[model samples]
Target chain A: SAVISQKPSRDICQRGTSLTIQCQVDSQVTMMFWYRQQPGQSLTLIATANQGSEATYESGFVIDKFPISRPNLTFSTLTVSNMSPEDSSIYLCSAHLWEADTQYFGPGTRLTVL
Target chain B: EDKVVQSPLSLVVHEGDTVTLNCSYEVTNFRSLLWYKQEKKAPTFLFMLTSSGIEKKSGRLSSILDKKELFSILNITATQTGDSAVYLCAANLYSGAGSYQLTFGKGTKLSVIP
Candidate 1:
């Protein structure tokens, strides 16, 4: 099992500001994913982070808004730029070993933009 | 569009009752299906189903996959108040070798009352 950790578990930010959330895994993983969960809604994949490549984002999400960086196999970060009330949500990170076919998640970063 | 749909968006049940959560999906390349339980924080992985006609069980929770039907079901028996939370279903999309992303359903919110 992999233990994932994220920094600043909870934070309240103001509009037009940016917040970068960090994720670290105990073991090396080829891929790391970032997700956003809005209130009363399910999770939506923000992007997939590769160890040394540009993050691949899902439709309706742009790198300029949610830039991601994965400099190594064990760490990645997601930056929410120019935050707004609509961007207030919980951001989570996950990693896994495919042979195990299971993914473990971090506690998540709860961001409330005012 | 590739998507996952879950039924009974919200349910209120009494303790000791049995409940079944449903998830259907439509994707180009479906690699696997997963179940997760989310309380107030991050989602905890429940089960991962890759093949049909196989049942994965753990305590009061169990799940099965039907690839031909493009759907899956999660069963919770002898439910307790502790089981109240949002049950999520996700579909893994296989884009290429060592590449995948998870698309989630809207989720089923279960509330177990006394």
Candidate 2:
């Protein structure tokens, strides 16, 4: 099991503003991912943060809207750019330990775009 | 596209009662199935099942996976008020690029009344 933390536990941003949420893991992980959870909905994977490489984004999500940066094995950041009211959701960061089947999640950053 | 569906979107029960939640998935390159409990923040890992016909137990919570049926079930006995939370089910799919991602279901919101 890995411990993960996210910055800016909750934030209210104006439309068109951008916010970058940071995720820090207690241990080095082989995989890191960004996920979004809208109100009353399940989580959807936004992208997979690859160390020293461009993130692999899921369908319906683009790099221009949600950019990810994974500089190392223990840290990553997801920036929600040009936010809108529809982008108001809970953003979570998860880390998967090597050979582990389970992924541990951060405390989640709740972003409310007004 | 991977899909995960959970039954009885919401459930209400009295303390000490037992309840069961169901999850079914349709995904490619299936790797594993996981259960999580979400309260106010992030979803916490509960169980990870990689093989079928195996029951994983933790305290009063138990889960079983059926690979052939493409579904799983989580059972809670002697439920408590503290058990009120959203129970999520996710299916892990191998991307074949040395990575795996999860597809989540619209969790079952369980409210345990005292």
Candidate 3:
């Protein structure tokens, strides 16, 4: 299992403002992913953060709205751009070892768009 | 569309009582099923089951999968107040290029009272 951490555990932002959440994993993982959990909703995949390459965005998510960057295997960032009140949710980052089919997630970033 | 469904969206159990959470999925190219416990902002990994009929246990929690039925069950014995949380189940599906997607169910919120 990998130790995952996210910066700015909680934030309150005005609508139209952008916030970038950083995720750091203690060890190198084969895959890194971003997910959104809306209030009373299930976890939805945002994108796959690929090292040295473009992140793969899932359906209903886009690069412009949620830009992700993974410069290395142990670090990644997710930026919510042009946020709206609907963007208020918990953003989580997960690290997958690949050797095991399990994914370990970080303490999520709680965002409140007012 | 691939989907995962959880039963009894919310459950209330008394301490020392046993509880069972169910997860069923209809996914293509299924690879694995994972269980997570969400207390606050983070959803902690609990178990990942790939094979059917094999139970995985940790402490007082145990889980088993039935691939033929496309379902899984997470059982917690002698539940405590600390065990109250939302339990999420996700199904991992194989995508191309060694990539995989995890489809999560709308977690079951469990409350344990003494």
lDDT tens readout by residue for model 2, B26-93: 99999999999999989999999988998999999999999999999999999999999999999988
Worst 10 residues of 2 chain B by lDDT: B92-101
CAPRI level of candidate 3: high
Candidate 1 lDDT over B14-113, as tens digits, reads: 9999999999999988889999999987899999999998999999999999999999999999999999999999998886767988889999999999
Task: Show the lowest summed lDDT stretch of 10 residues, model 3 chain B.
Answer: B92-101
DockQ of each: 0.86, 0.94, 0.90
Model 3 lDDT tens row, A32-109: 999999998989999999897899998899999999989888999999999999999999999887767778899999
Stretches of candidate 1 off by over 4 Å are none
Question: Of 1 and 3, which scores higher on lDDT?
Answer: 3
DockQ of 3: 0.90
TM-score of each: 0.97, 0.98, 0.98
Displacement of residue B63 (Cα, Å) in model 2 is 0.4
